[model samples]
Target chain A: MKYWGTLLLLPSLLFAQPEFFGYFESEASTMQLGSTNYNFGFNKFRLDVEARPNDHVQIGANINIQQYWGKTSWDVYDFIPVDHPTGQGLIFTIPDTILLDNFYMKLSFKLADLTVGRQQVSPGVGYAWNPVDIFNSKSLMDPSYEQPGVNALRVDIPLGDRSTVSSIILPKDVLDESTHQFTLKSGIGSFDLTATAAYESEKDWQTPLLGRYDVSERNLIGGSVIGEMLGWGVWVEGAYNTLKIDIPPWSSFLPPDSEETYAEYVVGIDHTFDNSLYMLVEYLHNELGVKKQENLSLNHYIFALEGEVNSLMQDYTFFYAMHPTFDYVTLSAIVFSNLNDTSGVFSPIIDWNVYEDTNLSFQGSLNWGDSDTEFGLQDWGLIMNITSTF
Target chain B: MKLKLLLLSPFLLLIAHAQGPTADQIVDRVTNIMSPENSHSKGSQTIITSSGKERVFEFESWAAEKGKSTLTRYTKPAAIRGQAFLMLNNADDIWSYFPRTKRIRKLASHAKKQKMQGSDFTYEDMGGGDVFQKKFKSRILTEETRDGAPTWKIEMSGIPEEDPPYPKIIMWVRQSDYYPIALDYYNEKDFNTKSLVLSDIQLIEEYPTAMEMVMTDNKERSSTTMRTLEITYAWEPPKGFFSERNLKK
Candidate 1:
């Protein structure tokens, strides 16, 4: 029966596919952390299909496959105690199978639009959560609580060129073992706001804000002030969240489990010189835990300076990140080839522009500090990303 | 009145000393140097260095008002067809074309020092800005041998402040063939920031052409641009390469 349904869905998709594109890339790397040496290389192939059936309907999906070859050195995070037979190692949960990345149908008419079936809902800049991005590897070391839900709905109303209001909703376990989320956003200029509420059935879903319990429920509200000042551009965003958790024994390591409220804020400023050099600085503060338990607060400060000397020597940037509260520092250099725009950032990374409307990237970080391991959590890893637009 | 005349006398003398060539004279010389009618008879070149290695790309370009201008690549087909170019010497408004997506976008502003495709070459280096349209006050600095060839040093300052990329520039035009042997750019903030050297001038088909051009930046590493193996001034394009519709096709 399932085979027949898949067959029925195939023909219509063939005629409706918007465009087809593919990209292939292979990379090799060797990492030296203290006395340990780890080397590995992988190649990835991706294909994306998008289609707009009519003025009111659209759909798209993506597929990616990758394989790593050779003896993989386990970093501290992946290093398991030799005594424990359950080796501490990296495991592939979502098989190298033909995984369904994203499948959605959207409808639009005059002042309104709706989307259904496995979709992401993102509002505002990348602050609390950017649902629109399904394959986000920017924070891979962190666990995921939900996979954007298997079903979602969206509505939008335009209030002229100056303003807009949008709302989104998705069901959790409506017909499957999926979670649910809903969000609404509205405003113009620097006074924009977004409110989101979510429910997850697999309470054990590892969402940082709601991770203490199994069945996680959360309410999120965020606001931003972004505008140009003087000849400089500046923006600030503040977000608050209320989370409820079904306590698990392990969570008792540091907390009195009850509904908790947390907040995070980010402020950034940038100015460009007439000579084509620009400097930017940003500060971020995330109250990881509830109000009184703000001891779990994470404060990150970043400073970056970029200059464009000429056409051929397009952009040169030096970036520094200091997690004062976490006692970690990250320094990076980014050079974009003005000649071809093939950009490279120091550190291990998978930078790709796979297709016209899609980009996939993965980068790993080496944790530095003076903890027991001296190497800190040297096992920080990003992820395989897949992005497409229709 | 005598005091005013005395003060103005030195200024007049300085003005006379600063005068170089008229706009029409420079335009006429440039036109004669790049004439499409006689391009087929000319051959010339320069050197190029990239990616820590130096290579030579030899080619010829022919431009005719009503006819077609063809630029053929001898060493590297990727450079010409790559996004490092923005050739615009056509009938309509000059168009800047990028080889990456193979599209021609329009050019705006008249900044004298704006870099071309991020290369050391400016928009003027790509041959879009007409020396005739912009006012210049040039001072003949000296006459010297460049790469063993006699060259004339001329400094040009833009009369209009709001011009393209560079506000002031210096150049060395070969006295014998009138080919530019070198160019320098000076901006307000960075002062003398970039320099371009042209050598190996070859008189192919009767026009002096530089077989190599090397540009250096005082800022970052791997910061250099080289244009070599040039077959300047082509007689004409192959039978039917240029068409109004071909611009889009």
Candidate 2:
């Protein structure tokens, strides 16, 4: 009801002749996880509305609806909302959702641009994985998918002709529970250099206990560089963050409160061959990642599944290749390899642009290696997606 | 006197190498005549396949500093709407903004050679008004009749440092207004691969403007025609209009 009210009031907020457009997408897939054969599909619709009242002010919003179909029942052990208590034999099903994906209002002044809203504020140069971005989790199946926006107020100020300084604040509850980030970006000839610092606090981050959370603190500093050398594009992104975790009472292994420092980095390169084949390769190193397949626990997996972490393995290599078979048809494939577990998965995609406003794509994935390996325990799937824009 | 010698040196050089105006002088004049201080144009490009299918894309563009810096935003074909390209640093740098990603990224220099939106226009053919003569050496070949008018036939070769996509080019310029009418691009094997022809020329604001242009790929048997519906050179953009801030908008 609140989303409907917001939808009803959207037009009034957009004063000018608003530019409205969006897309519809549907995907169906069948896969096997462990001893079970699973089949499911999802449909999504998104509408984007934007208005430029004048040269200095702009407003934009995106509303989305998503639903899944297939086996959707679960038990209490599956998980309960933090606000809702669970009882024995309690069961539930996934519900269709309508959400305000993101919205923003920007005012451009002579000195800077002040934008406040749910905005996409990620800083990284690597294509496969952005180590500096810890708030959003990654999907190995579709690494290039859109990222969920974060609620933030950002101010971008131009330092010089080719440099910028961006300050961002993400408020959670009180003032001390907020996340703040500052980045300085500059261009030196053909290279782009950026340095960033952040102080973050996650209020509802889960501990070992269910339906309970403790405030987690992470302080980070990072830098990245992107350049072209010898006709090939190259980039390096990295971050070093201090982590503090509080031991819950339910934990039997008493390590008390623990404090540590962790680091993550990604190095990447891309090149387009003379024949028009585009290839990209990236390598990631995570200091806190698991070193052996046997050491991977449910907690770490859940953390990776949620937004707390990006990867569960120590080292990973990502490779992508794309080629145009015709003017309207593109064939591409991506491989995600875990070095420590000696496991990998590869997905091949065929995209056909059926005219100007629609596209049909098909993807097939193969999970290879022993079941004890990291990626080998995942699903092998085939999917078809159809998208239409308006 | 040394002052007299110094003042007359330019004329001496012109007379020393002249059958008429040198190739560089003619190209410079044409560049100055075609490019203006500030300009904007709204146009549509129709791409025709060899099998007789057509797709139209609408766009509007603004350029400042005599075509050195430019911004072009697409407004048609729902899939590519709100996509924009920006070129700065005297056309030496390029950036692209995609609305879906909500991010602005810089393009490598070699991206200039690729076709734009699967069309016949390369990034080089769209931008870089002054970089043409800077990257190549041009010489007049002959005087010829083209399109029932007298034209100067010229040849251009790429300089070693630039490593241009096309190593050789043959161009025909109208004698009256120094407007370029036709250009033929040749590959390393001396095969004419693509051709661009300018038609529907008009004098707008005392400048010779090509209101319609057709670029054809000889081997592929396909072409794209660009038509300008509205244009002006008397408009000046707001201060700091070419900055990255405006590019995102």
Task: Identify the candidate with maximal lDDT.
Answer: 2
TM-score of predicted chain A against the true chain A, for each candidate: 0.61, 0.89
Instruction: Give one digit per residue, the lDDT tens place, for model 2 in A260-325.
Output: 688999998887664467888999998878887777665555456555666777899999998766
Query: lDDT per residue, candidate 1, B97-160, as tens digits?
Result: 3322223322222321344323455445544234423545666677788778887777777666
Worst 10 residues of 1 chain A by lDDT: A300-309
lDDT of 1 by residue, A34-100 (tens): 4655666666655656677775676655565666654443322233111222344333222233455
Highest-scoring model, DockQ: 2
| Model 2 DockQ (Cα-based) | 0.41
Off by over 4 Å in 1: A1-9, A27-29, A32-35, A70-97, A120-137, A140-151, A174-215, A248-258, A271-280, A289-367, A372-375, A379-390, B1-249
